[model samples]
Target: MANPDHEGDVGPQVAQREQRLSGLPQQVLYGVAYYAEYQPYDRLERDLDLMAAAELTVIRVGESVWSTWEPEDGRFELEWLHPVLDGAHARGIKVILGTPTYAMPPWLVRKYPEVTAERKTGVRIPYGHRQDGDYSNAAFRHYADRITRKVAGRYAPHPAVIGFQVDNEPGMELFHNRAAFQGFVDRLRHTYDDDPQRLNREWGLVYWSHRIARWDELWPPDGNTVPSYDLAWRRYQSQLTTDFIAAQAEIVRELARPDQFVTTCMALKRPAFDPRELNRSLDIAAVNPYYPMQDALTMPEPPPDAPQLEWETHSGVWAIHYQADLARAALRQPFLVTETNALSIGASHGNFPAFDGQWRQAAWALVARGARMIEYWHWHSIHYGHEQFWLGVLNHDGEPGRAYAEVQRIAAEFKQAGAAVVGLEPTADVALLYSRESKWAMEFHPPLATAAGAADRSSYERIFSRFYEGLFTAGVQTEILFAQDFDGTEHPVLIVPGLYVADDALLDRLAAYAHDGGHLVLSFRGGYADHEARPRTTKQPGRLFEAVGATYDEYTNLTAPVRCSGDFTGAATAWADALQPTTAETLAYYEHPHLGRWPAITTHEHGKGRVTYVGTLPDRELAVGLARWLRPNPDVFADRPKTVTVTSGRAPEGGLVRFVANWSWEQARLALPVAMTDVLNGTDLAFGEELHLGAWDVRVLLERPRKKDDEEGRPLA
Candidate 1:
């Protein structure tokens, strides 16, 4: 939806109209986020007849009011959302709309206070919250391109709108203003071409003296203490938030309508987010997963010193399927949850809604990970200002309670699993990878520490969520690659945890994906630094040290847990790596006596693949015994109960589905590992029978026949 030549590429005729979801409607779209300008009275025909008696199809609407769509500047009230999009297209819902430009209007911050935002260099950022200005200010992109072309030219031919969200969660504030630090010193004078000594020997900048001979003696990133100048000022503030959401998806694809569509909701812990270069200028991928509901979605988790939730939700249930496998790994297809947990999300002493069948077990675990749409994040409840108790789904007396009868039984089980689970596709044995420039060079040099010792800047999500919760507690099924979309013959078990800022062409493509047979793993501070966060002096895991047969210039940081013995036992917290194997084959060691002379895990082989490595940070029963020895084939509801989990995918005729759930409150059971069919109950079971489930249940099923030459229900890229 955005090829206006900002040159960040998305062309191919706008990627073939964003692979057609054009006016959506295949199913799985249950909804909310209907503001009706935060209704205090006059219920827009009782919120579109309780969103068509709760079998809602969609809603979204006016992204958090830019002062009720410009109450004063250029004075345009634009028919107050034309009776909420003509009463949500008279019942059969739909809508979406949204471009109120991340709430700025206090009279455009009292008439352009130099478009606010600074957070340090001059310290501005005063105006009341909501993305406090400076979206690369040129008078804030001329009033955010005149209210995003007057709200996409006043709701582009609204036959129940269809799509457009533009900006409501865009890289929240990395704008150290003064035109975002002179546009990061004119993008470092066109990325060092104006060579300030080749950006002083590629950012080593001769250390403390901070070299730089010109290019306006480059400085500002708030007193930067250089980690390759904070990973090139966090890759130029995530390329000014992917050039302000690809210039608002090229101003809503010049008034939308090639069947609408255009997105931007990703609040996936935004530190100047990237979302694979902002979903290459939007046309799909939307996020905001938000987790932690009741017993924090149980399942023997809640330990590593519980009491979490310090914002941007997510706590367990393998972090809600790792935020729906990171919103289906961004542009790797099927997405859109937009906002989640419609009730009790943040502040009001952080309430914790969802219990009776946990909103159908987190909407079938975000539709078994690929998620076509869930919506939430509202629909009544705002009785006044800063999210008054953030609870919605018709609360604060708007009526229909129990989170609107558990989102109307998950919108009648997504309308009886319509279109066999809309856009399924999710299936992965293990791939993981994910970097975001090694999470912005481990948030500028944090090699794990916190336990009060400081500097744990979530050390790359604590070493990639302990190997993605040990491949979701060894029921394995991951898929989140990134180093420019890695392949290794379509991931025959990749892993690669804290790949600390790699380069040498991604360590020669993970040593040629382990000399071509795959199964590469490697963990702890991988290939220790290269792509400008420097450090690779060519020894310690650098440049895949002989395909990781192992080497380590000593490492430490474990304030407690240490154990570890033979074939991968538990214990090995924080950080470690002292391994000195040579042609590798140690598979676990350190019971600690001078860290048992090295090895805490190792392996080799290399040509026709097999690398392994690890060297510490396992714990979680050594990441579920190294994800059940790197996925030793099982998962077809792998003997259930541990508060059951399952997952699976494919479905839209090519059939397979699965989902399962259970998340404990007791009654669990399992058995049937094949002959299926319940898809929200059209019953019929067989193959080994049983199944059951109950409390916080979920189910779904499908399976029998429909394989259509299944390459495991294709779609992984």
Candidate 2:
């Protein structure tokens, strides 16, 4: 490989990243999941060639091959890896190597009892199953460190070795081992070692009263059923789980690219660990979401809103929740669709099923929202075809199937048009304040009200879904961000969704944004706490409430049918803020199912600025209408234009790239910014006019200038 200096052209390092955007190319690195179960070294080499020829430039090797790679334990096996990586690089494909963590060998889990996890029922779990490493045990880290440093340290400098995934899907399920449970207790003990009584006080449990005794008494409430106590314990367990992953990540980060990107591919339905905790240590987020209907309810036919309903279950509703998590994920840092069934599942048990063009379009929808990459769930399974839904492009024969051809065609299209779509961060008008610790803390707390209650679905998910689906469908570029994710320069206005707490830094920054005439909107749930997991009754929003021109009163938690109207629209009311309108005037209020005393939404003045709060649940109409009224953009794409999508990305060269898509049924003219060369066609187009975009055709205008720091949004090049 030629050591190319990252001067002006496509930076090789950025280009070598382990992902490529589905509709864009700067993200072209692709992965063919190569597991030990199918160690087709011969076919593997040939496959690498196929990937390169198709311009799919990445390979993700499994982390758990203990039974084979380290079959003798403590012994290293580079025999199988060296050629696999070298062969890929020989064909110009980069590789993201796993650290043998996904599945532990039977002997390792069997022999070292500490390496295994514990179930909530006090049963000791074992191996043969995958993702079974115990994070609590020092021994697990010890062994993990050895494998990581040994593998990563050796391969970090290699041209072929692009990145390392610590453990594939680290906490896919709850740790059901007593040792793992005991380890969590040990962590709590270590965190509060100085005072046992203080622990009891903070936890509101008097040990002598049998509230808690030995550490073993502390258990998470995730037995596929819930009790009040279990809820608290579950939250605690989640925090501990988070620490374990971070601890492992810290160890890996120390040895791997101090500057290199690291990410754990999240399990679709079973990513047990909080993504927020992992965000601190990760560079890119991997989104592997599943769309399982909520329950027995079938979807209504041809719904008034939303796209065509291919699914008719709680799965569709769950998909909204899934998308919300991703939308608000670490300020929505472009994530990878790490796992989507390459094809539909066949009626049989494990056979690979075929996916339709709809599936492909569904995937692109995610790309349009925020994902940086689109990685299929899997490549091959020894169980043969029909063993599982078709997650692979090739069947057991390793031959290109329909899925393979779809991906290949997509890849080729991207090759011609992707460069212009790189580094485009979402232009967020709203900062849905989300925090990792908040989620962990809330989940860990005992259930509100009483025992045997309905499950507490994430409200963050609710707000995100409403805002994301509504705004995105309208084709408005809005960002979902954490209060601390990026500076206000990235945005002129910031919308804080129900994250009611803030650190001094965030508070001060909000103050700064207000002083700079920035418009800040705080959702009903905002300003409820400080940085620490403590109530913000101190000064009511603690210290920053004054800057936002409002003070927190009491949290009025309500149920469904909540609405906010300007002095009075007839929308039903849920929860409201009994706020005293100080410098701020009331913009909207909760309507009468329960009225006047409820301030559903309010607006206030500050240093050349304004702050607004939505004190109730926002439906699509309110969200969009309010957004339009507040930070309205005059140059919005009128009449819901399709095929021609507008996007802006941060260029590796520190410039910007604006993308134009032609996802239309027929050739359509797209509004262009400059005398542009459609990177796809490699031809220049007339500037400042409507340029014809062909059906399903796309154009990328590169070398865009800096964005204007105004309401007009990122400027014309």
Candidate 3:
């Protein structure tokens, strides 16, 4: 029966809306995954109201709706979906309809055994869990394409439809096998388009392994760690996945008569797969920051001073400064905080962990950092997974639990502050390229000693963790850019901390950036090798070191608390390397007891460029010193707002609001330069107004009115 509410799915434009995929409105988008199975129309409808009450502009319906969208092969079901889309639209929320393909129904997988790829041990598992489905399977790919095309073609012109989110988090379960490896090997043979010698040059094969002969001889390497041939092939496979999703999304756009934006949501912390790759493929790349949630119950202890996420699986950003820093840097477009927890995790004591005022501050902290879209991972707390995966922003009863109230209040206050700090980009003086390859390749494995120490679990991880903490305490705006990501003209101060393996081509770009009067910093293993992690194109310390006038004499892993007698912020009792500079100046000497007279820090000049190198990871105090030494007090402010100042991007809308957030439960008087109207309370501010910000209160200076526009007797331009 045609749904009475949807009005027979209306216009050609209405049909096009289903195919459309644009970002939500100007205000900060607060969203929750509108799970089809768990939430019926009424609940989905209510949550949609709460979502808007919280100022959410986008509603993401899960692809698990496949059973409803295309119940059986070749049959389409729009009766249930039409109302959901129509309901969200009626409430002024954009709908991001997911393509029904993440988890294939058991019926399809069972019927086509060819769908499940074999493991290295030759055991083929059926499509069972959420992460199942073989991307390489023709049948799987075909059906996914067909269903997605139908959704796109049918709904592309709908006004309420803003974007088409194709598939939910693909490539979850990976195949590290010879067959998948060989598939790519065959692909590589076809690379250079039939010139065999070029492959030898790149692969460095003296005698091409007999295991690799014709394209058919290839097999996807069946191992957790990629064998050489498979490493390059994995990139190809990643490309294939990108192309597959892109093709599906494109078809929907084409057939539906494109109107809005389109993309997919991604798990940012995936080890092998790159978020950059995901970002590259999508229009508005959404991220799941489940950093503290998955393992929150396992977190060691409450920090004496601060509150951290529960179980931080990927420790670096989850716990450290890189957490928000990456969000500001990764994508140029407005980003989304697609996941968080209102209730934290369930404790071993048989109760759900609750959020305090601190959790509320942290959520705002994400907003201050430029999260255009924020959603608690799940709406209702559940009794599953040992209470480990804390996805709920509300309790099971859907009542105003502790976190629920906090999220509601903050979102409500922000709603009154229209487009205040929504679209702001990350502006930073310090550039720390957070390389995917560095995080994945240099993190840890057998043979290679991590950050330092023989028996240490993961030295590099430890160093990265400590470095991020140090940088945060130092209070500098830092960005994570990859060596591959550095555009020719980068920021003024570029700091490359650990196992850097940029190819010569990339090194030349870095040199040019340095040559263009920018400052560069290197420490420990800088310019160590090429992409393959081999001896590198130009040898130890690579070619750029010479340009920076530095040479790496040795790389030694020492435990921290590095002690030096000189005037250092704090001693570096341990370090990872002892570098020597040629025709350069030594900033800090490695005179520590164990360091034994090697250079731990140095500075040099090449062309118009300046380079600084740190041989060891120092304490936070010294890191502050180094940060000061890089760009110094110029970025420092005289008139301070609240400790938490928010800069946003939604400029077309009036006023950029900076929330001087004072969360210590203490009153704060903050000095301001520009006068602003409080979007939340509608209070007006005068220049140099001292804010009597109450404890746990956010005194937001709504829109900083422009002097030029004010002088012209018009609304600030």
Candidate 4:
């Protein structure tokens, strides 16, 4: 197959980056998942033509049709994929070939019934859908390896195949059969040095007559009521996913060439395991950031007194930005947007498609945060399947529409300034510590609920979002750091929201961070439990109580909204802690009828740094106040409107590249901090001059080159 001519405009930087192995794209990688097996050869040919016209540079295929690749048992008919691969290469598109292990062939499942995952009750999950196989089963691994190696060996040397997706969103299910449970027990025994006493003690298994006498007596987290045990089970399940993906990655590395990369996309919202841990084994990080814009609207209402969000809740690309930032941190490098809604449709609700320029805006949001590639969920809407209605770039008629046109516009933008965008590296001084362990603990037993007995399911997420949006509104770029990854030396200010589960070591680390001159912020119910979600055998906030200089003995689930008195005044809701400060200064207190004089917020100085403890969820203004207090002197776009967000990074050409985005419905006007050139429009902007931004619009500005003296670290003239 002869390579087709370049269809769209190609930038100089994009042309220069063609020889690179692994890094940010020279130009953006416009890709889609193409299912040639589902279409006739003639239709497939026409689709490739249209793909080239749309300036698509990459295509992911072969991952969806394992049954087509190998119909009979051990009968690998791999020749059918050759045409697709050749066609992609001929169209000047690289291929991210997938290991067909996510879904099992019917023959393999029929021969090995244990390959399917079993529920807690031992009922095997029926094998009609994808991701149904047991990740830890030895039999499953054997077949997974065989089929993966068969595909890898055949395509490892293919010129068009640039990388391999080890598995499709590897950790979406948990296998709870006999083998998996035995593996968990073995891991626990190994962790506790084969001492059942230590295991029972650490896990607090003596509660409710749940003590384990022997290692074998320990059960999988099926119906266990113990939060510690359930947390351990979830972590173990994550380990299984990591090991499963690693196994496939190792296989690919052994067969593929050095230039060929390996990665697995994450369907992140409810990941079966920690994605950060799993990405360590892969070459690059990728996430399917399904920004829940419409999904958020359909969500159940919160408690009557709970702080409700406005239309700005999920209107923008912060969901994408947040996930991309996390993915970049996980890989410690630029990552990829493996999948996003081409038309914003889902399985149940048919969401409205991208309106006008929203698609380009969302795409640029990913690029601004260090996404090397962005691919739509699929090329076209499937004719038959559960996701048939989840529309793609093309409608069911397979014709280019509004989304396709938007993508073309994005391709042209990349051709113009892809080099500048690709060269920039995102920087953030504010970091939010995130813990999956804490999330799991909250799931087991949330700290707050509604007066009518409705579970405040959004407690953890709400608190985190409150702080995140606070930082965003304060014009601070933020990075999400996991406990294992953060040592507190990277960011000057760190905020941890609702850290319900933590180890003494982590608590000590937080204290050390404050002692070492880092500003620390802790929210309500933080440090209340050990790493396993067991109540720490100490005071609330546990070992870090000294660092925080405050201890909470009593808390309340707020039935009505309350306001704060003292230093900061704002509405508080959901929960409040009766904090007694020993060496800390009270920043705020509850002004309620009965709760008056109770400390709502406190701050303590430790060594060269300080720690601030918030006892309840503060309203937006108060959250921003806390942020402003933590980051005094106003370096970033301070005092900016809550609807505006600023993300700044070092541009490829030397100076800073700032992305100013307005996610609100009303027009926002902000003064430029410094004179700069708008890269998006090639217009020069003056310092301190107010610039207007229409709703949902963004401006990418490159800071003007500094003076020669400034370059030498001299004072500006």
For each candidate in turn, the TM-score is 0.40, 0.74, 0.82, 0.90
Model number with the top TM-score:
4
**How close to the true structure is residue 442 of candidate 3, measured as C-alpha lDDT?**
52
Which 10-residue span in candidate 3 carries the lowest summed lDDT? Answer: 1-10
* TM-score, candidate number 3: 0.82
In candidate 2 the C-alpha lDDT for residue 574 amounts to: 36
Which tens-of-lDDT digit does each residue in 1-717 have in candidate 4? Answer: 112222122365234223234533477687888887765334878888888888888988888777877898788889888888898889888888888888788888899898889876488998798888898999988878888899999998998988889889877777788999899888888888999999878877778788888877776666778877778788998999999998998998889877778888887665477867887767778888766442231111122332222312332345567777777767556778889868756654546665465677677778878787889988888878788877788888888888788888777777676668773568776778888778777767877675686776556777787787666555567877776665555567889998988887888888888888888899998888877777776887787888899897888988777988777767788889989999999999888777886789999999998999999988867876777676633553664665666787665566677777766556788887677788867999887788888866678887777676553233111
lDDT of 1 at 133: 81
lDDT of 3 at 295: 23
RMSD of 2: 7.5
lDDT of 4 at 662: 68
- For model 3 the local lDDT of residue 567 reads 37
Expressed as tens digits, the lDDT of each residue in 19-134 for candidate 1 is: 53666877889888888777878889977898888878888888778777778888878788898888878888888888878778888778778888887888898887788887
Model 3, 612: alpha-carbon shift in Å?
1.0
Question: Of models 1 and 2, which has the larger lDDT?
Answer: 1
Better of 3 and 4 by TM-score: 4
Error of 2 at 402 (Å): 3.4
